[model samples]
Target: MTDTYADLLACEDLLLFASAAISSTGQREFHSGAAEQRLSLEFLHEYVHGTHPDLYALALALHVNDHNAAAIVHRLLSNPRTGASAGERARENALIRRRLAEMPPQRVYRLFARLARERVNNRRTRATMRAWIAARPNLDLDAVKYRPGLRAAARHARVALPEEVGVFLFSPPGERRRHRYGSPLLRAHGRAHYSASDLYDLPYTVAEGFAARHRVPRGVFLEGVRERATRAERLRLAGTARRHGVGAGPDPAAAPLLRLCVYVLSLPTAERRDRRAELEGALAASALRAAGPAAGTWPRTAAVLDDSYSSIGSPVRRHHPLAAALACHHLIRALAPDSTSHWVSGHTDPLTVRPAGPTHLAERILDALDTGPARVVVVSDGHDSTPPLLADTLTLWRRYVDPDRATAMVHLNPVFDADGLGMRPLSPAVPTIGLRDPRTLPSLVELARFGEGRLGLSDLREHLRATADAYLEAP
Candidate 1:
């Protein structure tokens, strides 16, 4: 990781700047590897106004003594993603015109942003997040609620209400996943498939999606849902069933409750954080009535890909000898274009895996629902081909839940310490709880009954104190 001063100066400055620009704005780069290989295409003179001001400064500091500018540029150019945008290219041309004037290249606002992100990484934000993920398996979606709630999920009107209402089930790895929403809403409306692809990719990170309630069901999606007679039918019926409202169905207490299962799957660490923020922002807006914090009780949400860590790319995981066909199917789909990605020029299509769609994500949600008997509502970004798979997964898991009561909600939530301060799941095979009714976020936290410790990220400071004490005892 050591570099000579002259080594840094000679690298391609334009390419470096472009990489930094993209990083600052948080945009995905469609064109990769073009900058590193193609150097001679833009036959411009060596410009001191290098692409990255910080990189230039570092190089300057290193090679300033040697006065060896060319050598430094050569080293920096070795790292890629340095192409300049049209405007930057024009600015470069102008700077070259006055090469004799030799003004230090002006700093772009973009560079500052990239540098800030760099500083944060250096400070260990990533390390903290990783530790959080690996700390422990905190919930089992199966045992979240008891029976009597399974018949009418996401509804409380049934007179035979269970002591604890089941909202959703969480299914982890190595288990059959299903969902009530498994059936494709699109199929009843038009000619859409009933099931979607499974989660083939392993270690897929998931989270409750961000977007305030009411504000959620985005305009684009709402329009689509409105077109669906079943969705409209359900909404209209729910309205009539409201307590004060007429024809609000049979329940006078069932508020205007619409449970949306929002799941952000396999997003990069940074994007995951961003999505969480978005969800928090939307929830905090109070645009929609809030529910309890749904402790780790999300519907069956697990990603099952062939175990191929240390692979070159996500696609390469398929090149192995011990992989399942369906696993490959799911992996390829996850590796393929995101729901909204556009094709590149002259590139018809990758002919690779296609998306499983919203139905698939929802099916997983529904499958998780079986782990317990509860009324649940699932919401997601609704992209990808998730809708179809959802319909099928539910019944499949139902059969698996219990052959006798085969369709009954399965006990997925294997709560290890139901009465402990920090309860976590212990089902090695599968354990996780689905999230239903997001307004229940507040209830998710089970504070220490004796007030010893709290359960959640916000309790990190307390965790740190305990860790520090343990370290002292060990020493």
Candidate 2:
């Protein structure tokens, strides 16, 4: 089969598989393409119902190489009967959009071209093409090779191309030749966006040249180069950045500068110590208030901040779960005067606690909740290394210290659970939320209320959707 046809078939098969998986109430098998075996619809149903987030991620990755699969993903996302929550579906949609944006617009246009011929009546395919076109208005509209298919798709979709593109498309071969901007090959390469991943395979000088040509911002430049730079090279880069006013501007709102400093500290300890004052200054400036709680209309919150090795082991520095946990602690303490903080490490004082030792979570967590705080929040990776079983401990806490279970207890996990599929609840009693973006903490609390029977997934989804919509609409 031709490449376009194969891609179309793959997309169709994936959509069928997903639809079958979702529609299965208890059936064991569904014939999908050549695959003729039981794939455990029960597990898949459970997975989509909120057992794991990874399954959806896996589904995305399965046919990611095929641009047509994006249409399938869009369809899967819109299917209301699927077990995935509205928030999960929205997150998947966002992921697909980002992935689409990262691709060369030509490829997306070509996919549209192929879909136009193969699935002429597909409204989703046409809508998807229009979305990509709208996102990249800077792209040359007439750059695509397969003119007839794309023109048909655009016409059917009622998509109005720019005047120049429309003129080029309709004009005869000689006219098109005259108006052609440049070698399509060269233009395609020029339009390919380079990201931090580009640094891994390319030479440093080449990457630097690409960044300079693109006028990539200082923070992005640092992220692109940090892992590959030598200690001395990093210092030199920092000095140059300071001189050029690259990263020397006033702090932006909700800046994660503290986490960035911790990433800097992750370099050889001796090399990092020279900038100790700078790190300290960032921490101080970012804080809304000094240590200790402030008066406010806040609940008596209790938090067990996990400083275990896992939190510090995040692949992305900006997402250092430990730093995020510390930031959360500071924010809660500053906002809620009656709050108590528990640092889960080998220290009594919260400030002195460091991320060491395999998490001895069950005991420390139970002890924190036993204090009778109005609400309990556990920021962890949900790994109880030394445990009289976390679930058992939670049972004990509920039985004695919290018979009424009045406290809104939540497990905020920043790490993706590859094993459990989604963020795993520490116990059946506590709700676990995937804390991928800490800014979503406000809406995520509703999940805890859902677990407590005070709310539902619909409520959590509404709150999350509002938050996402507001962010999108923000000036």
Candidate 3:
């Protein structure tokens, strides 16, 4: 092939891989099984790394899910030769550190454990693992909560631990029970196996096993742990807490937008209705927080949201697609107060939207376009019940109705099409970007310009480089 054709092909391939990274978390989707998802994702990662190693490294800065982020870190760390130059290697190392810091503690520990399992015990791996473990704000909490993972990582990386922590982790069970510990957290953990009261002092996740072993009453355990639970832990345990008659669950207002949307959808319809005021207020506030300075800026924007049955997602994800659409619904409302929303099922209330209808995307597209907005954002999995009709509709609208292209459209798909190894686009006329987190909505929309074929491969490389630099420089 000619040089231009090769560059175009490379650009398309990179975009496809990027979309997969953003949407696929190696989990089952509505139409694809978990194994298929994993296989496709692995293949894409390999292809992208082989073809465009620099862009693959830069993808760490994008809104990739935890699974892909871990995978990227593993690939880069395991294969030092992947970086062709000293500067490239430094950038990759910096990106790895940033991504690792952004991930949850459990995930970072798990990544370290995986590295140990794979026997990837290179000098760089050892240093990175040791540094991360040493930098943790509370190693005592990690020892209690993630004992096995922390122990394995420390051993693999040969990370020296605090004197008390070393004994707490490596001591035999008999010795641990007999020896007195300096750290209160460690002392509680050692006593938790025999003492129920001590379990309350430990993190809730670690305390639960001991609580069960002691056969502590669920209600009592919950009440005891309520004061100690973190915000995220409280949100997760709220339903159980309510069932057990613990204080009214954590306030919804403090939750992040995407998480709040998922939490709301996890509740039964009756509870959601009963808590309508609280939930709606939380959603609105979270959306404003997510939008930040960009809130209420796009007065002429419209959204075509999909609430079809396929959006029910898989058991693993549980209403993930619908949740994304719901989050986008709130975000769009916040970003453009006057924007029109056209749901596929014609559902007017965002709070009670359930996935239970055919994907009539063509009609919704038509409705959105009729609003005469400057931009139209379509959030869907692109599984239209009537094949080709949505594409045909957009084609006709773009060709005859809006020949001047006054209205711009982009599709943000949350479901990964495993068979296709990328997002299932509704129409070639519109750019389809993968949607993972609602907070990244504005940036992803701006990124749609690259997917529209308006920019060349050089522009994409430049964009990735600039994005990497900005991310590394950010606090």
Candidate 4:
């Protein structure tokens, strides 16, 4: 079971879903009965009771209304043995609050009132409730049983209590409160539900208004808004967010601008040149640059980045693979400033290759090996379009360049190989490591340390144990 967990962690296709089952970091863009089946309460409970409560917290966030989830929440709230720290509890509550704001107004009121009754009043929780209530002037505050306490607390804290909270919570439930306007949180959620095509036509003011009204951190919601935004609207949103100190609306790991870059790169050569500056600037501003090499004697490493058309994918390409490749290229350059030994797509220059061609892993490997570097690393999706000669090239590289059979080549796959069950290695001699997140570039350094061969089970276990211990030890 533990081995399965470890393998799932390394499996890109499963990791996010697995991670989401236990943690809030998982992608919840698609929420349906089918998606719910991917994460079971039993699995969540086990993880919640295990070393990674953060994972379960995320799962709970997604399945907050589930009976099993509610039970786990009750258990966690009552017991300290769930492995959740003070910080983790606070984070989960905050996530729940944000999710509540995205739900219907009546649902939000019910959930908030339930939490208030249960006394789950963290600072962020109270503040979020206050923000929602402040935005909705027509809500019946009497529905909230703890209205008096909340009102008193707001008054004592000199917080701006809603005018309707003064009227309805103090009056009978039969007499409903009326207002001049509707619920802003519900309105925001409504605005957020616009179809992709419909979103482009809506004025940017709608998005800005939602952002201004909602205090809860709706990053995922904001990201969706930016995704459907027009080029002009995207730029406008970015500039507005910066001015308002909200930073970028989208996740930097899979930023919309990066996808736009990939889209622009796919255009005709003459057209692509026009957007090169924008593409380069966005890449530079991303979190990838921070994964720069440490100050030390770097190894003689050659990195081959895949900028193939397959890497960018079809329909909705997040450009994550291309981004990871660029990140690796930047990492290598930062570590070994003097090393000009790297390839992207067919080009030897990493920056010159746009994601526009078919994959030729054999050619890239041969090119890198020809340089006689101590280590050859290929960053690809393992979807070689040219030929099945990658293994032959690895064999040749191992035979001539590395007669001692030292670690000659390593394949770092940014995209998970669903059919292969795990990351695919070109040959038995050459091992593969999953590069789901660019922050794991340090793992590349660990591979560099394995100067003579693949990492064994013991080696992998030791790394996992250390990681588990470190996460458990963190506050």
Candidate 5:
């Protein structure tokens, strides 16, 4: 393949002077002293021979006979940009004046023409380079070579990368990428080839550059490919694919899944308008909070995956999704502590809900009541009262869900108050639906435990309320 650009480090730079000198007729005058003086052909030859400006001038100076002239030309050309220091330049000019006074003009012209040819070579190289630029294709995956493997696949793939790249692992079926990491087996014995189409992938292209910079040979650990990939770069690279169906749109919302004990509670009064307003309001505030100068924050959206937050946290910084997720998580935890570990993982983003501590209690309650969504009977201390709004949330869910498929998911905190009062709600008539005084919640749990068959909704609610009342009225 033809080289597309002439490395300025190597050639076209010299052509600038050659073109100028070939067209000029000397005895050109230059200022060697404070005043201008006519330069002898030989003197001029030493000053202009091989380098850009000098080469052209030397061509005009009849510099062919001067072998040493190239050396002087280099000396002046290589010196600092401000031009040579006064003392060194002055002495050099004196020596050139002596030689110019001795050489014939015809001999000078002959030497000048020869050196001009050297300058022609510079132009020729550039012309060739321009042609290459006009001909070569854009860099693509065909450029990279990977090892062969049966199950090579991109795992930590980034959608929009500033550069195209694909990271894959070679392993047996069902073995996660972690097992196949960039170990020597995958690097050597495994087989996977970098297809030209992979150049369209953002992460893969980035990895190529990273590999080149760090001197990492191909087929290395797939981790390095997407490790430092940023969200901005991913967004930019993916934009093209999105427009052309290259990749799916990223989920900017997958962030709220991080907090532990996260509970989403829609107020009992939540209507379509109210729910819309609440969600939108949360998003709006999230936007402004992230608009500040120091806004990057990624939370563990997945309950068990908080530590893995860094994997996507660094990239999420550019888009501010991390902050938004944190905002949602912060608000939701005040609602539901039972279903916190569950989250929705999607193509656009992953959602994390926190896991509450009393999973064991919740499990025991579920095992006992498999018939329907068990009614939740929370018995917690006054200090840990379940919010009134959250209490109604379970009732609201039961309205739409099948009892057999639903889970009451109770959080029973059986503890006495400072005044030695029970924590269960004393009456359903009390507008505030907080946990019954913690001491009284036990009677309700006990009633459910003694149930003959699956507790019907009305009966279960009645018994649970009576137990709360009895616990409260008891001395």
Candidate 6:
């Protein structure tokens, strides 16, 4: 019984840390400032790593955001391995490799730069850094785009670079101007200083700097760089591109589901209404793609979505919580097809749903429960107000009305509640999971079972091991 109780505590701790890891990026939320968020996150990372180092490492294989993943890698690599078997260390190393590969190039470069700054040049760290940098498809492009970071990483890792690439990165400005580079991108970078035409051949981010240096007109530079911009870049610069009289940017349908939702919410209500057909069609298609095989799988689903004022999030992450809710709203509908969404403010239109009124989650929960959905998914920051009866309602519903536990329910919180040290739970009766992206909703719901106290620590470990194995095995 003592061992069981200990396992239960460990499970709870893991869940709590996972929630913070997935949702919090050490940025300010609606209620918490950046400092508080960072401090809380740091404490949780240390506590979890001390308590369960293996589970802490396994989180990299899960849906942890890039920020926390970098932190996890740093923490794991900074410390020497002890007590773990050879197989365990190998699994941890594999997890790190996969995660570093999965992170965006700029972020990984930044992580490498950070490791260099911290002087974390252990054998494992050096090998990991060297391997990742050596794996880059185009070191010339990296040198041009992320010169300082690439140089720092190479120096710290002691990894040798191609001669021209090394000169492009390490040579002084005068020396680079005197020398010629074989790589077109590297040559373009050197020429971009004096030649406006050469800037277009470089990546948009690198070209932007050269364009500014050359005093090129914004319109002309934008036109020239349009072809060089990535899909995500085009979407991000759509408004700017339009203001400068570029074409109607990229198609909305090309956006990933979560990014598209954020973009849709960023637009004014009138614009969203005007482009309702195009936007809705794109959202439906993206959500369907994100749902994949799970699309239209669950029947009679209901979602109690929070569009309360708190969903406005902080200035650093404007409408982030609401964006998560909006994305999940469409995803749940796609997943169940017949899923009903009940907004806390009683708003019906998902497109025009904005964060305004106080959170009234209890009433929405009651409305959703009345519909007898096979699954009740609540997407909120978990800040229920106007009497705060969400806990009681869920508790009583589970105890009296749903004693058989036929209806499944899970709370997905997009914002981390620093005060709670995890996602603020609607109730202990319902399992709450931190959600960063709507695409991971299905798997996250499945993962929430351990938090329900029914699954032991061994079961949780098995799940983590399986997840890590699959993650490593995937191409």
Top-scoring candidate (lDDT): 6
Candidate 4 lDDT, tens digit per residue, 1-475?
Answer: 2345444343322233332232221122111222333344344455445644444444333323333344444434433345457876666665444444444454444444455566665555556556656655444322242345455444433356455544434445334333322544323333444433233223344454445555425544455455546564554355355445654543333354334334334445554356467555555444334444462245677878788776664333345577567666655655555544455455654445566777777877777766667667787777777445877767776777677855456677655333333444566556566554454555544533332233333454455445434434445
- What lDDT score is found at residue 2 in candidate 1? 38
Clash pairs, candidate 4, are 22-55, 22-56, 23-55, 23-58, 24-58
Against the true structure, candidate 2 reaches a TM-score of 0.54
TM-scores vs. true structure, each candidate:
0.16, 0.54, 0.97, 0.50, 0.17, 0.98
lDDT, candidate 4, equals 0.49
Q: lDDT for model 6, please.
A: 0.89
Q: Distance from true position, residue 463, model 6, in Å?
A: 0.9
Predicted candidate 4, C-alpha RMSD: 11.3
lDDT (10s digit) by residue, model 2, range 169-272: 66675565456445443233233234444443333434566677677776667665566554444543664555555544323222453344344434455544
List model 3 lDDT by residue over 138-227, tens digit each. Answer: 998888888888999999999989977788789998887778888888888878888888899988888888999999999999999888
Error of 2 at 404 (Å): 2.4
**Model number with the top TM-score:** 6
Ranking by TM-score: 6, 3, 2, 4, 5, 1
| TM-score (C-alpha) between model 5 and the true structure | 0.17
For 364-419, candidate 5 gives per-residue lDDT tens digits of 22232343322333222212123354345434444554344344333322111212
lDDT of 2 at 436: 36
lDDT for each candidate structure: 0.25, 0.52, 0.88, 0.49, 0.29, 0.89
Which residue runs of candidate 4 sit more than 4 Å off their true CA positions? 1-272, 275-288, 292-297, 341-345, 348-352, 386-388, 403-408, 444-455, 469-475
Error of 4 at 435 (Å): 2.1
Preferred candidate (TM-score higher): 1 or 5? 5
Output the worst ten-in-a-row residue range by lDDT, candidate 1.
199-208
